[model samples]
Target: MDSSGWFMWALLSAVFAAMTAIFAKLGLEGVDSDFATLVRTAVILIMLAAIVLVLGKWRNPLQLGGRTWFFLVLSALATGASWLCYFRALQLGEASKVAPVDKLSLLLVAVFAFVFLGERPGAWSWFGIALVGAGVFILGLKR
Candidate 1:
């Protein structure tokens, strides 16, 4: 729960996300997108349940209130939708291309945070966003 722990979690998440793209591309070689998504979701759910049980956090969900539950459900649905689209894209396009396009969501998130969360990123952050945009544009032009 400390800063280093959070950083490690973020790093691990990124690694796993990259691996997900590779594995998904392989898995979708001859599979329909929808069926691939279902299989992926089922496997992730089972893995998550095992982790929660092993960590003794199975009851953690019982601590959520109505608003938390609503948001959690909404987030899960959004995640599922993202996975569906990501897999579909992977099935139909190059992983390098699809991954960069998917990462554009970070720009969208930054804009949303600025508008809704009143977050004002400093000059460096804005520069980083500009660079990401440029990179995405260049990636798109590659094909």
Candidate 2:
């Protein structure tokens, strides 16, 4: 099986995301969710900065155009909001159920890509999204 590098990276990301929810849930015990998110964000920022430095990928910040800055800033703001809400949800809910609900973003992203980016996914992709939706609904039930 020849797996693309992008697929491998995405797989790793999913694994890390799963671990993140469990670890965060445990760590958030008796802690403020907002404070936990701040600490997590700070660690991520420092780690990413270290990677940029180590890889010598630094470039002139001024080189980025306004359009780039606009989208990147918006993405950053969205990410921060999502994290805040997610952490708060995790603080109040069970990780097992919360994580599946959070993963509903995958289906939402697919639909958003089709609508906003003009990237169309075919039948199988739609089936996958439906399956994801069903899975989320199943996990959400208090059985």
Candidate 3:
């Protein structure tokens, strides 16, 4: 596998996402989930803003087209909603169960991409989605 590639970054994302569930779950102890989510979002905002400032990506936003702005804003809203729901879920349930069901977004994304973006998954992609769904059902669906 290439060390410096998109796949590597995506793998890192998965690792970090797993860590996020554990860390957030731990943080939710004796705290309101919504308040925790607010604090987390604030920290993320600050960190991301710092990174963008340091990297001089401030100009990047100005360069975005209207479509890019629209989509990104929509994505931001969706992400916020997801985080809120996820934190609430994590607070109320076990991370092992919550994370997998949360990840069913992957399966939904495949279907959504096909319908909305005209991005059809090939046979293996479909197979992988099915496999992941089944795995999640087995591992995360049971109480």
Candidate 4:
């Protein structure tokens, strides 16, 4: 894919993430957050499985490299934890507030990439990350 294609995909991801927050907030009514998370995970698993099968993209998991498997497992664990916390937050807080706080991960990702991935974001990129941090901070202030 073209290097520029990432922007479009990232934009779509943001759109879907916004939808997820709204939908999850509504779905949490009269439901346990953890259970709701499980249901959502199951749905995602089924949907992705179908997509993979339809696209003939299924590969033997056992054939993957140990490092790949390890990191994928770690990533999956982190995602699961994030979903659990997000669902609970949605259960107890306003979606508008919770979503922005959740997006604090964007700033965290930049910092982590710089430290662990040896990714030196340019000055403009750092400026953008700072803006995101400030936005999240401003949104977090109590009325």
Badly placed stretches (over 4 Å) of model 3 are 1-4, 60-63, 140-143
**TM per prediction:** 0.90, 0.95, 0.90, 0.96
Which runs in model 1 stand beyond 4 Å of their true positions?
60-63
Error of 4 at 80 (Å): 0.2
Greater-TM-score candidate between 1 and 2: 2
Q: Which residue pairs does candidate 3 place in steric collision?
A: none
Per-residue C-alpha lDDT of model 1 across residues 1-143, encoded as one tens digit per residue: 67568878888988988888888898898899989999988998999999999998777667889999998899899999998899999999989789888888888888989998999999999899988888888888945
lDDT of each residue in 79-114, candidate 3, tens digit only: 999999999999999898899989989999999999
Best by lDDT: 4
RMSD of each: 2.2, 1.3, 1.9, 1.4
Model 2 clash tally?
0
Q: Write the residue-wise lDDT of candidate 2 on 10-75 in tens digits.
A: 889999999999999999999999999999999999999999999999899899999999999999
lDDT of 1 at 89: 91
Error of 3 at 128 (Å): 1.0
What lDDT would each prediction earn against the true structure? 0.88, 0.95, 0.93, 0.97
Highest TM-score: give the candidate number: 4
